[model samples]
Target: MASVSMKDVALAAGVSQPAVSYAYNRPSKLSQAQREHILEVAASLGYPGPNVLGRSLRSGKIGAIGLMMMDKLSLAFADPCTIALLRGISEVGELENVALTLFPLNNNRLVGRSPAANHGSLALRGLVDGLIISTLPDDHPAVLAVVKQNIPFVVIDSPLVDDSFFVGIDDRGAARTQMQHLLDLGHRKIGVIIDRLNPDGYRGPIDPQRFKSASERIVRERLTGYVEAASAAGLAFEDLSIIEAGGLDSTSGQAAAFTLLTSNDVTAVVACSDVMAIACMKTAHALNRNVPQTLSVIGFDDIPEAVQLGLTTIGQPMVEKGVYAARMLTEQLNAPAGTRLEPEQKIFATKLIVRTSTLKI
Candidate 1:
């Protein structure tokens, strides 16, 4: 096949080389009729216009961004909460005409690929102009690789990175509110379930010392809030048991629930997510333990399924967080080369939505 060049289009349209270039890239430099004629001639010659690589190299921008996550893309989308966040991100990406690339480090393992192997490729290949980390731990290998590469990134709901933008909810205050609800109901025997204590999915009773990692910032903050609220009520950490779920899904929630229910006499349970709360409710139902009667459950993230199941949950603006994070990244990308913008910490508020899943115990 013969390759069509700008020279061919210029000769066919009777325009200079610069005029042909202007017609495709700098259209304002040419009259409307001249630009239309040049495009029509280029179409006739089977020219597909300039290569993306050529355009990107000339502009010093890729017109795209990458989103990093440790979980599989399929599992990430399964949760409506994550779907909401993706929706917000796509909304801005569509409006700004930017593409989004997902990097799920764990799934790549099946094909003998590791995030470390790809991290270097991303830098050398220029896969994206910027990056957004959804929920990597503070010291995650992927996070470390990105930091080492000095890529522009925003951390969402994880360890607060120095000189990096962060977007998250006031998890501690929100957890305290939910814990107070259960505590106010005369339920001192409360249990807590965290989706992740460490990146390894270590389930079972979490050691008190294990809660100090910045990687578990969200979990630590929420537990701290619960402890503070309990202390204000003249209660101690010994009054409750804390367990880490096996995974981020409902099965993990079920396991955590069983351990808490069988091991202790908890009248109420607080889960870190509505998905986990739903799983605990199912486990309770299977065990013939009536909800709000034998056990009351409260979860974070008021996902659509939570409303359908009448689950009492904490509502956070997942979509808004995504939107704000993407906007900050875009702003950073558009900033002057040497301009320094102070890192911004944006915290969204959470609300307690009372539903059938929780009640006075």
Candidate 2:
């Protein structure tokens, strides 16, 4: 039996080889009827279409982008904030009619545990045209792998390493504003619930050096902003009373709230995210503490639930961030190498959404 080829398909379909290739690789180049006819003929002839690897090599485009996340795919899907960003990315993808491939990092390894550990292998595998990585640490091993591969990539809510493209809010400034809202309300005893600083996922006292080393860009920036705001208002860092949450969710927020609210000296709680802040509210209610009167609370990221709960927070454009990231990656994939996009660091502004969650003391 003779093997089927593009030439064979073209000859049978009554079209040129280039036309057959166009029907498979560049579908838009052919009329809809022509493309359908070619596909139908190829399918009847048992041709499986063109080789993707060969097409990629010839066109220098994969028509797809990689979206990398730190946590499991299930967790990423569960988070509303992450979902919004993903929706934004999907919108752009829909417009371009390209697919987004999810590359999961094997969590079984000890030394190479994180998604960063396997980034090099994934990037070198030539599965994606570019990468859009969402993680805490900008210098994570997986991120470095993307860099080593020299693949066009973008970072979202991570540190700026080597002037790569990024889409995020002003972490330090937003944190400062959020904390200052509590300060202005005369809530002196403020407590903070922060996500883990290190990739090892330790939940305890944050050592300065280790925090510096393991901290993602957003975490460090927001912490700095909170610290700065506290200092400016004459509140000592020691008095800030920080609790490190194992993860960024309601459960961790509630646990942190339980610990902080139990203290008679604590009057206000500042959560890093709306999910945590709302969790703190639920915990406070369980503890019989009246919100805004006995304990004022503030959260960041004005997710949908935040507004309903009247939770005061800093509103970062989550959807826009995702959209911008997708746009940036697409642009990088389309652009020539060595040419940087305009405004490499796309920083979105945040606003303080004052609601019923906080009150003047």
lDDT tens readout by residue for model 1, 266-355: 889988888888888988888888897889999999988998989998999999988888766765564434556567788898999998
Instruction: Please report the TM-score between candidate 2 and the true structure.
Output: 0.78
TM agreement with the true structure for every prediction: 0.78, 0.78
Report the error of model 2 at residue 284, Å: 0.8
Worst 10 residues of 2 by lDDT: 104-113
| Candidate 1: pairs in clash | none
- TM-score, cand. 1: 0.78
